[model samples]
Target: MASPIHQRLREDVLASVFAPDEPLTEAKLTERYGASRTPVREALQRLEQDGLVERRGKAVVVRTHSAEEIIDIYESRIILEQAAAAKAAVKATALDRQLLTGLLTQMQQLDPSDGRSLAETNRAFHAQLWRATHSPSLIGLLERLDQQVRRYTLTTLTYPGRWPVVLADYAELLAAIGDGDSARAGEVAARHMSDALDIRLKMYAEDPRTL
Candidate 1:
């Protein structure tokens, strides 16, 4: 069984792997995660099985998105997010709306230039949205997709002037959900996901190797 130290190392690997520019190696991971080589090796092996990391010769590297993988992920996200939004709009309790509103408020106060903070908040917001559906299976599926989306979104965050637009879309999505308009909520969610995918696809086209 993997120890707690190994699990923590795995999470560190996932978070640091957000940027494709970085190469993940046991030495760097050991230094950064403050763990021994044994745990780092174990963590990397687990990450590889999860499809989050891969072996490159003797080095372990973060998995980079290919064009096809990007499309498939976006396609999956669109279907899942739209369905979740529609369900959430109809089924979300008053407490759920309030919670989502609170997250949006927090997001609005964040500095758009702070990619790390924004990424964390952005993830929280989406996870909360997924939870609104009250479907464990759906939530679980979205959680898996979330990891893939995070990598793509990280790339998009590097582009200048994209955060504001992302916030605006989140605002629109919140409004639809708050109004209990299932169809509109679904439409907005689909459009939002589609836009992100479009940006990621463009980024990949510009540099296929980086993704």
Candidate 2:
């Protein structure tokens, strides 16, 4: 298990509590997180290894991605997430299905204007899907990649007309999994990522802050 400081710092970084490219100096982090210098330094090192932070000249700051890098990440995610969904179709247990169904119901009932809630729910739903694959290596890789993506504060779910579309994609993916149709599940997963990439580009075009 990760040390408490490391985990807390990781969560804060992933949640954008620390903005991208913001300096993560040891003194400030130690004061903010109430940790000693050594632990804080170690936590920063771990976060760097996780790709959530990097040394920028003389300072360590939250990692930032360019448009080209973001696109590449999404493309890689499409392939890996496709494999994960396919594996989930074959391996997901009754409990996994139950959990996914509950999350889907919550998402369906959520108000469209609640972007924060929608983003949280969407993250949970995808995390559950990753767990459903029951592959430790795969889950680790997906979670790491997802952490990098989540460092960007804005979610594609908040884009106009995107929430309902995401719901539809989830419904199809769930149905395919329920039927144990791996191929269908994989296809749906790939298409979902592709659509997200397109929406992300549109969001960036409208507002660079979404990057």
Candidate 3:
């Protein structure tokens, strides 16, 4: 069983993978995360089990998404996120509303060059909204889905001219939620995922190997 420290380290490592511009190694992980090889190895093994990384011979690298995988993930996300949005519209408290508003503002101010920051913020916002549903089972499923597509989620944010569209969709979704319009909120959330999936498809078409 992994200790709490090891679990924390595993999450930290995954966060770093979500941010990295290139593949990481154990030496790099040791240098960056200030851990010995044993815990780093343990943490990375956990991450691999979570589908957040993959081993390449002696090297362990952050996982990258394929076109087919991207499609599948987005299909799942569209279903879950739309349901979450609708639930949030019906159930979100004033505190949830305030928190989401603050996140949206922060997202708007984010530098486009900082893809990792944008992706993290995006994940937090969606996760927070999902949590409003107060469904542990649903939350657990979304968390797994988030892990499965972490690579593509980060990759799509790195694409040129993508952030603005994302921000706009978020704005609309937030508005629908704030107005307590469950149907509109759900529709917006589903459309948002669809648009992102379309962009991913185009990127794949352009260069299947790179994505």
Best by lDDT: 2
Candidate 3 lDDT over 48-151, as tens digits, reads 88877787776777676667777888899899989988988988888988898899899999888887898889899888888877778778888888877664
Off by over 4 Å in 2: 19-21
What is candidate 1's local distance difference test score? 0.80
Model 3: lDDT of residue 196: 81
Model 1 Cα lDDT, one tens digit per residue, 98-211: 888898889889887777888888888888998899989989888887775455576675466677787788788888888889999999899888888787777777887546
210: Cα error in model 3, Å = 3.5
88, model 3: CA deviation in Å?
A: 0.6
Clashes of each: 0, 0, 0
- Lowest lDDT 10-mer window, candidate 1? 13-22
Prediction RMSDs, each to the true structure: 3.6, 1.5, 4.3
Model 3 ranges with Cα > 4 A deviation = 1-5, 8-49, 53-65
Q: Tens-digit lDDT track for model 2 on 66-106?
A: 99999999999999999999999999999999999999999
Model 2: per-residue Cα lDDT at residue 22: 81
User: Model 2: what TM-score?
Assistant: 0.94
TM-score result, candidate 3: 0.75
